[model samples]
Target: MDAKLLEILVCPVCKGLLHLDKARQELICRGDRLAFAIKDGIPVMLESEARELPADEEVGQ
Candidate 1:
């Protein structure tokens, strides 16, 4: 993901800042407990496209 893009990216549902999960290729929204996937180098920011984060999932600091 582009640095500038990541800096501006936010959760579609809650308008919260996102954390890039490089290993999973997803942008994590802690406030919303969602993970927006990065497909073909572009973020899928739609709420319908997001995956619900599991309780056991670990988010980056």
Candidate 2:
């Protein structure tokens, strides 16, 4: 993900900050408990396209 893009990207549902999980290629929204996937270098930010995050998952940069 681009550093500039990550700085501006937010959760579409709650307008919350997102943490980039580079290894998993996902953007995590802790407030909404959701994860937006990055497919082929493009972020899928739609709420319907997002996946529910697991309780044990940790959010980090």
Tell me, by lDDT, which candidate is best: 1
Model 2 reaches what TM-score against the true structure?
Answer: 0.89
- Model number with the top TM-score: 1
What are the clashing pairs of model 2? none
Error of 1 at 21 (Å): 0.2
Error of 1 at 16 (Å): 0.6
TM-score of each: 0.93, 0.89
lDDT of 2: 0.90
RMSD of 2: 1.2
- Which 10 consecutive residues of model 1 have the lowest summed lDDT? 52-61
Cα deviation in Å at residue 37, candidate 2? 0.4
lDDT of 1 by residue, 1-61 (tens): 9999999888889899999999999999999899999999999999998999889987776
